[model samples]
Target: IATRGLVDLPIDVLIRIAVRLPRVEAVARLACTCRDLHSPAFFEAAMRERTARRGGEVPLPSGRRRRETMVQALCRGERRDRFQRQNKIAAGDYHSVFVSEEGRLMTCGTHSFRDNPQPILGHSELDDEDLQVIGGDSVLVVPRPVAGLADVRVRTVATGYAHTLAVSEAGAVYSFGLGESGGLGHGNEADQHTPRVIESLRGVRAVAASGGLNHSLVLSAAGEVYSFGAGDRGQIGHDPESLFVPSRDRQEVTERLQLTPRVIDSLQGVRVVAVAAGAYHSLLLSEAQHVYSLGGGGATRRSSSRGRTSRFTGPQWTPQINEALRKVNVVAVSGGLGYSLVLSEQRHVYAFGNGSHGELGNGRDHSSTLYEFTSDGLQQINARIRAQQRALATTDAFGRHGYEVFRHSMTLADEAVPRLIESLGGVRVVGISAGGSMQTGGTGHSLVLSDEGEVYSFGCNGYGELGRNFDNESEELPTSVPHVVETLRGTRVVEIAAGGASSLAATATGAAYGWGRSECTGLREQVGERKSATPLRFADLELAHG
Candidate 1:
């Protein structure tokens, strides 16, 4: 028998050897050793073996297209194979989190007080070096396992303006990060740098949880609701009396803050199946298919029968039934800063509240010049102007107010109550997400995923959050995310998420894509471009795991 060197072996035999390599890196090194082993057929066979290891099929190249390598590196040099094991993902104002199959938690993006806190120029007077070392500001461009949470098995995760919440497989809740306004639900306003279980919920098994701008909601397995944090706007679902006792002389009611979880008495016997939180509002969907809304009521100034300004309107302090949606069999609900969306079993969609930026998808022409100013209309307009002034004074002090001014100038004909979004009548919507901070007057946006794996977006596109290639102009009606739909033509979208100014989508094949504002989270650089006008493949995402 003649002994032959490895490089002299036939391409087919060398490919078989390469496929047996334990790691993709190992196969790459083997290919580098011999020109014959570096052939496309060899790499393709190796890729097929890796796909089989990940429990997925390696899609054959279509037409003249070749099979591109599915594996890529994350920004921080972490392999995409590591991210393929994640089961869930969530995004906050400036950060994102992922949970692995083994329950390991990984986080990335800017988790700094400077990025998430309300813009207060003098909140910290530390020097640059001190701010970097002691201000609790940090950035992780690459996914890194959350420190001290190695042993805990996280089942799901949720993010808010400046904090994060994770539920364990054992039904225990863990909270961390900015704790201002009692958002941490720790019974005190103290920031938690590490994962800490909420002692009060030790005996209660939480099935679902949501985090808002400054509040949190937890749903128990028995359909009970628990809330804590800023209740000034009645987002906590407390009784109006408990929030504030109206006085004859005080024009402004002192907003109440809750530091610990409290049961929503109004929904004691109601079986709430799902809960969603906005900047200052909460939405609940019950087992009977009824929907309820709370908070954002105190912001509307209405004249009472006695001619005094009735600050409390509709359902602000209590979990009142949404009368407009009483006739619809609501199966899903999503809440934004100033609006809410509901999906019926029939796939019909309904929206309510502010639609100045077309967040409602009602197709109302906001640019019409027709003017009609009645006494009541004038009062409403004046109130809105006052509110806008206050918002500008605090945060948008030097920002543009053109959109606000134009929106206020138009007739106030947008939906204030639940109305059917006829534009999406034929499509079956299975998922929905809303972005923008209602409390901050940011032009909000909305996204919906249909049953056919298609995505539609409306509302603000100033930063290209809509992903329609149209800049600045808001979409008053739903439009398709063409790039995403075309790129993943044959794949079914499995999950979707919307952040303050960005959107994410994941396919059944485990592929991930993202678009929109990339500054705060450093996503622009990760996508290898500075502009985020269209969806880009998360090149580092590996969908297969062995």
Candidate 2:
């Protein structure tokens, strides 16, 4: 058949030949080889067949219109194959990172050149001159491979306010960027412009890691949790005694900082399977399906008999089990600046603390309503209701009026305890992501991906982070972002992430979509800009075909 005139073959035979080719690019290139075989119908059929075989939408051969693959739909503006190799994505307050299927890493967003000043250094065989800084001081508007890590096979990445951490396949952790407050786990308060291995964790195999504004957490293969960085608010999980000694002056530990990684002995016995970090708190999920929380007074505050707020303190501080989460086994957890979310074994989601921006997803705004009623006002309302009840005909009237008053009073109250997000009931939530913080001046938001491949976002949409089109408003209930749903209609969302005021979703086909806060680097626009509330497909990278 090769020796014969290939163009003379039957259309059916030609399609079979094209289908057998190893790559879509190959088939595309073949279509351009000769006019005899150049048929729009043939090309379209070949692409449709290839897409169908790869689990993509396939149109009917007769009368039905074809559906676009997530890739095709997202690659509209500029046609490039860079996104074809992306497998995972992480977003930070002002930057984003992408991990390719082959372990290559690419980053976009805000990065400082003042620290390094020099070109990025690495062990790649390529010459130093080859690794030049494209644009100095300007925000990286597109995803570009990090030079120094060219040889490092990155498995996952986590971004902080202004820093980045990457875990390699061998469990080696590399950190870079703002090291202030020790968020880099490098045992020093020095900024790093190039990727540097955290010498303290050199031999320790880290299975997972997360970064907060001024702190970092790493989970080892042995299930131990190591934390480093600022501990002023106990974000480092160190014992209070170790951090400050008894003093008659009773001075506050104003310089509370951990310059190196320290293991949290309190978690020694528990086999932690996952870890998450907020701006000032940390969450751990153990193998036994128990959730543990440490640090930050906002999320875990106890009112003492004296009516003063007391916080849990210690090195290996006894982690508080979210008491509101009883009977339900938690499988995953995420934290925002002052709020937390946990996914139960049954896929039910429970949220606690700070509903200020509706991050709690409980249909209330605590920021504006928390102080609406003072103690005196509540007493006055109770007195008026009691007086009114005395004049009522039956006790039922008082009961109904009292219930209404109670409901109204609690409407805007902060969820100091875990409360089931009733709006998400009946939807089997498989994953949860929370974003924004005081550090970034973001209103904060939350996102959850359902088992049915749908994503629901709520909370602050001030910058269109929720992908809801409208901005400056908040959604107290979980609402689906119609544009995102319609854009990637047939794709299954495998993972979801939330940044300062941005959201990202990765599909089963390795397609990645990002929306909100254009400064995060995932968007094509410049810093301080905003994009459509709908997710824009990443044009730089895509998952490589199997």
Candidate 3:
């Protein structure tokens, strides 16, 4: 029997195959190998998925060729995988979660080391509730299938600060973890040891979901955003006044809690296709390729000269489109501890908010090596530096902004405006991540996946999160680290996830590698002598995902 090329297959059949391949790179490769998939039928399939998820009537300009616009939306889920049909992996503050090829949810990491653990493993508290093995004084857990969701076919999984949210193929949303302040969306503030469907969202099928430090966001297939949990800083996208409840600690004071799934009225007509929950803020993306931010975006006021004054962008209880990100055509957005990020359609990464520990990835952080000013004086100098950057907005070929050399004086500066990372010049990046620094001094690192399947890591490496190992143990890590992670230098990473002080990358062949603090990474001692700075594969992860 002769072998027919995959490209010779029907357009519908090719699309079905693409949808099942689980990675966008595979689909792109298929199209590359066979030019037949470039026909209008294939483009239409891509167009249909984009339009359906974004709720946009116009995915293309008036006169562009199908091939031209087709490349724009290719590679991975643009809206933070808001419309992704399936997800293979997820990384949290202290756990690694995966959705197997068979649609089973697999998890590994420390779950509640302090005796009374939050049921983050997705195992029912009733059966999996035994105290974890006590290795000395630390509690450790082994990777296993989520017993509570054993029968349900989970499509995508998201790991939050201390919580987990799983979306089913049938569009059901199940949550487990620390449920304080109503983060669980169970109509009450109760921790779910096992996965439980949010009854209020039963009628509307959720396409994706995200969990913040103390909040939860669920996205509908129709491009609507539903929010719950602590609305103290407006992360939930609801009226700030209505979020106040009587404080349990004091009767005279109030607290924050939104117990049920409430559609964000502010984003009603806007059509939000994705959501990203930071430590205290939230980032949302619209179908129109615009990014929106809310909650406590730090009040780092910077005065600009060319009408680019920066103030508190939002605490907008109501979600509003970011004017700075208006024309960039943002495809993906991520939030972390005191910082946020956006990936442009051109593969350029823009960062703003806080660069305290170099999360901005522009190769600088608020350090004392170059500056002798006090904290207050440092803020003033930073304001001037940002003001100067805003004066000249012309971008070079590599998205590099032209600015005065005064950056030397104020070496330690935080980004008030969405600054384009000049260091990542000439690389067409495909994916990006910003990990939160909930533990350690600061692990708010950033990782960018390039078109060539290599990863560029920067920001904090307090626990070897950068994965760029050296010959000696004490090689002296840089203050603002930004370079291609050594272990992943030659490897082709299909997906990546950053956590508190660890980093994870998935290869095309289904192998996963992680590096960072020992407690978080699933890597075992046998993976090259347990070097924290080197990327190593965990046997448990291999067995689970494989």
Candidate 4:
């Protein structure tokens, strides 16, 4: 039939032929030559064949609109995947943790670099002989599996500023890394270089766990919640009357140590099912689909309550069932820096807190509210700190970096209450994740997974956390990253995570992809200098023998 003409057969038959072709280039050439197969439908069907290659291990997305947008992207040849994925992924400030189906764990990136080197990679740095000092900074270019935990099967993992947590299938919790603020939950504030079970909660089966910048939360199989670490802003859900955390700056400093995991009595009989955290706040979900809020501190120092001042320059929000989300039927929640995301059972996304960098995804940012300071040494500098300059959106005043922050002129606005994202009204969202920190461009970003397995991102693109495919200039602009992640439209993302300035996605076929603000994550000098990243293979694998 092809000998006579490419269009001699039905379009469906032509599509089947194009999909079986081994090379994407071959499919591209054929689509160009045969006008009938050049359209989005044909391209989508062909690319979708990738799922069949996985032996139907994962299902296709459930939304037609998502399928169409994803296929259109595949037709444009925007995909570039070549590896498989792990069972689970947990992203943090500058590093990540991966748990494989084989019950093994691996981690990359670190919290320490030059002056005082620390091994927060869940492995030893001394064992790595070939570690390079590029541009006078130590850099971790690749991921390595952790050594311990050969006997236990890890089901989930979480990462914090300088620590890591692993929950075994047996519901046992293991922690490692920095011990400051009693983050390890071991009764003492001492760093654990290796995994150690929290002897205190050995009897209670922990079902889920989450970490904050300086605090942590744990949930029991029976619906009880436990919290520890710093509670200066009430992150450690304990009685305010008995709460006490050391704070040199605040005259109201408490005389108590936030050392061990204690049950949050307020959530008693509440049947809490899930937990999420950010730099200075935490969120809880009840079995009844109710959302709970706790802590509130970040980049902006504005107080939600008049004349009230707390740490991070705001009045602290105590743990309480959010009245606004009382009837929203929230299924999941995630937070970062000063903002939070709620995924409702109705496939709607609600955001609140900070919107200075567009983290809200409502098509509006605090650009209109930026206040400039004419202070000395406050030069126009890129907060993303890229090696090369991308397009710069006009702003009234630059942010604080090497200069004194108060000397810089800027204002961060708060959304105050959870509101539905009107722009995403048409898409059926299945998952939502948020990531951030105090970066020059606000660093907060949000990610949503459509029912069709497509990813949409908004907020700060200063660090490439949005992960938009730049194949077409019109579709993606680095200066203003779009909402939908076109590069991932074709892949059925089964898992996704957002960190301080990075994003991770795992496909239905078990392949993983990541992109975000890589500028000096405070661990590696080279990683901090943002640029189109592609580390030499040999260098990444040189110390692979370790």
- Per-candidate count of clashing residue pairs (backbone under 3 Å): 0, 13, 0, 5
lDDT of 1 by residue, 287-353 (tens): 5556777776312212222332222243367877776666675677777655677777667777765
Worst 10 contiguous positions by lDDT, candidate 2: 390-399
Clashes of 1: 0
lDDT of 2 at 275: 80
True-structure RMSD for candidate 2: 16.0
For TM-score, the strongest prediction is 3
Instruction: Estimate candidate 2's alpha-carbon lDDT, on a 0 to 1 scale.
Output: 0.62
Over the stretch 1-546, how does candidate 2's per-residue lDDT look in tens digits?
Answer: 357777777778888888788876677688878875556556666666665554333322211214644333222101111111222677777677778767777776654353433111111223333222323333455567788788999877787767788888899989887777778877777887779999989899976788887788887866678888877666667875575322236443354677778898776556665788877678886654556787653444432333333332222245655545634567678877656788876778887755555677777653233323678975665465344321111111011123223322322424656778888877877778877634333356788888778888877665567776543433322232212345445768878888887788887777778887665643634434444476788785774222
Best by lDDT: 3
Q: Write the per-residue lDDT of candidate 3 for residues 24-132, one digit (tens) a residue.
A: 5566676677567766678557545544444334433321223555445433233334333244666777677777667888776665665656566666543354233
The ten-residue window of minimal lDDT in model 3 covers 391-400
What are the runs in model 2 whose C-alpha is more than 4 Å off? 1-87, 112-137, 244-253, 302-317, 372-413, 439-442, 471-487, 522-529, 544-546
Off by over 4 Å in 1: 1-87, 113-139, 240-253, 297-315, 365-413, 438-441, 470-489, 525-531, 539-546
How large an RMSD does model 1 have? 15.6
lDDT of each: 0.60, 0.62, 0.66, 0.61
Taking all chains together, each candidate's TM-score versus the true structure is 0.67, 0.67, 0.76, 0.68
Name model 4 segments beyond 4 Å from true.
1-87, 125-136, 247-257, 298-318, 370-413, 439-442, 469-482, 518-546
Q: Number of clashes in model 2?
A: 13
What's the CA error at residue 32 for candidate 4, in Å? Answer: 50
What does the lDDT read for residue 195 in candidate 2? 90
Q: What's the lDDT for residue 373 in model 1? A: 52
Name model 3 segments beyond 4 Å from true. Answer: 1-86, 125-141, 250-254, 299-309, 368-411, 470-481, 524-531, 540-546
Error of 2 at 150 (Å): 0.9
